[model samples]
Target: MTPRPTKKSPDRGDARIRLLEAARDIIRAKGFAATSVDDLCKAAEVTKGAFFHHFKSKEDLGVAAAEFWAETTSSLFVNAPYHQPADPLDRVLAYIAFRKAIIQGDLAEFTCLAGTMIQEVHASSDPIREACGRAILGHADTLVADIEAARQAHDIEGDWTAESLARHTQTVLQGAFILAKAGNDPEIARESLDHLDRYVRQLFKLTEENKC
Candidate 1:
């Protein structure tokens, strides 16, 4: 199905933002390679001229889309309720729980834009792949402090650093989305997160009953 844009039309000057929003939704559904410039223009309710005015090429738009994804999701995770917990471990677990909870509605709604884009363009486009990588890794960076804190608080012994574990969280999530897509079930994504939650719990020497 051709995914509908999140909005119909913006006021006169918001075309760029609308196009990026359209790219986020459409690319998540159809992927970067499959989604054409014409498709984006149609979804954004803008002309082809307007798209080229903002983005020099489709590749430029792909880079911008990845950066946009990073900025928007960064704000969301920063302000999320998961960060409210007093305990670092609680915060970490809460983050996992929050990820699991948000797996609702359409797959395109909850899946990572960067993940989808990177999987498709990683081999073919250097700039787009880097942009997508930065977005994914940068988001993973947000979890590092909390993971490190939990590690120290629990004196957790391991070969892994907070950074590696943080990236691993994304790995699990991206893999989960792939599984969800393959199985055509959102629960598959949630179930992968459940395993992630358990892994973190075990890493911190906490039991299932002790989960936050």
Candidate 2:
């Protein structure tokens, strides 16, 4: 949902793709446990037989949905406006800006699927949980290279590693989504991102007047 631009697609794709797309949106909105196979099938306009043909069980579909989320979202980041800046730190800050920029429409419209699924299924469903872990951590990992680049470029030295801070960005982001979901306000999430921006600036010894 972070990309927000392509909120929903036409129902022109094949059954498997249609189901995966439905799961992506439905699970983000309804939570993994509450969204049943029938709900997904109805949304995707597919039959139960088609659902089972593509996925063995709901758990299997959960895993596939996490994987699908990872695949679809990574492309958004790769070509995002965040990468336009010259300085690595600027790029990092731009990445945050891009994140905030995309937090539009309803809360469910912009929530993170992996973050949502992992929280719901971590204890009860290991396959889904692990799949979510890979999606979340994989996204976190994407930030490492840019973060490390910014660290080296700025000559930043700290007890913290780029890897940890990169992971932390996701931590704050996911937490923001959780708050927004509970509060029924998207601003709650954007406000957390505001703090995230300030925290990252603080980490890099940036005063407000001089921050990227």
Candidate 3:
């Protein structure tokens, strides 16, 4: 058999991760338009050459950062410990609790990086807009699956289908983040989610009779 190629050093991966994390922190603090390649390089502690070696352009880095953030944030749902409970409503409630904790936590990072970037770059950059769309779509799809499972588990009654509800939920959450960022209050975000919680509770009440 041919000899195995040498293992790629982890340094590159580490550098990339550092760059993405730095980008997230910087973008969260400053909008995409205000953030520059130099800022990212300084924040990441990597040289401009190193940054360019991994990313073709600042726009490219923005796209990659969106994907990186999506993948990282999606893990919160995918790897959540709560998978089972008699009431499917409980799983959904657990998800809401997790979301609340994320918003109210110390970092107090309000809106999504992709959302912020999209708002800043949508007028000028097709790539960034597309990246933000994909990030949002991925999140909506994940929510759809969970909502469907919860609906089936509890037999909830609503006029909307899983996908519709999923989109609605995503809209509410995104708007909540915007409000939170604009108002500089995580409590506002939590308040926005409260409406959703009420809706879910109503559905749960109706479905109780259908429980096996």
The candidate that achieves the highest TM-score relative to the unseen native structure: 1
Whole-model Cα lDDT of every candidate shown, in order = 0.90, 0.88, 0.74
User: Residue 202's C-alpha lDDT in candidate 2?
Assistant: 88
* Candidate 1 global TM-score: 0.95
Better of 1 and 2 by TM-score: 1
- What are the clash counts of all predictions, listed in order? 0, 0, 0
TM-score each candidate.
Answer: 0.95, 0.93, 0.83
> In model 3, where do residues sit more than 4 Å from their true spots?
1-13, 105-110, 204-212
Q: lDDT for model 2, please.
A: 0.88
Alpha carbon lDDT at 83, candidate 3? 46
Model 1 lDDT at residue 207: 70
Clashing residue pairs, candidate 3? none
lDDT winner between candidates 1 and 2: 1
Residue 133 error, candidate 3, Å:
1.8
Candidate 1 error regions (>4 Å): 1-8
lDDT of 1 at 45: 88
Q: What order do you get sorting by lDDT, best first?
A: 1, 2, 3
lDDT of 1 by residue, 2-95 (tens): 2345555568588898889889998998989899999999888899999999999999999999998898777778788999989999999999
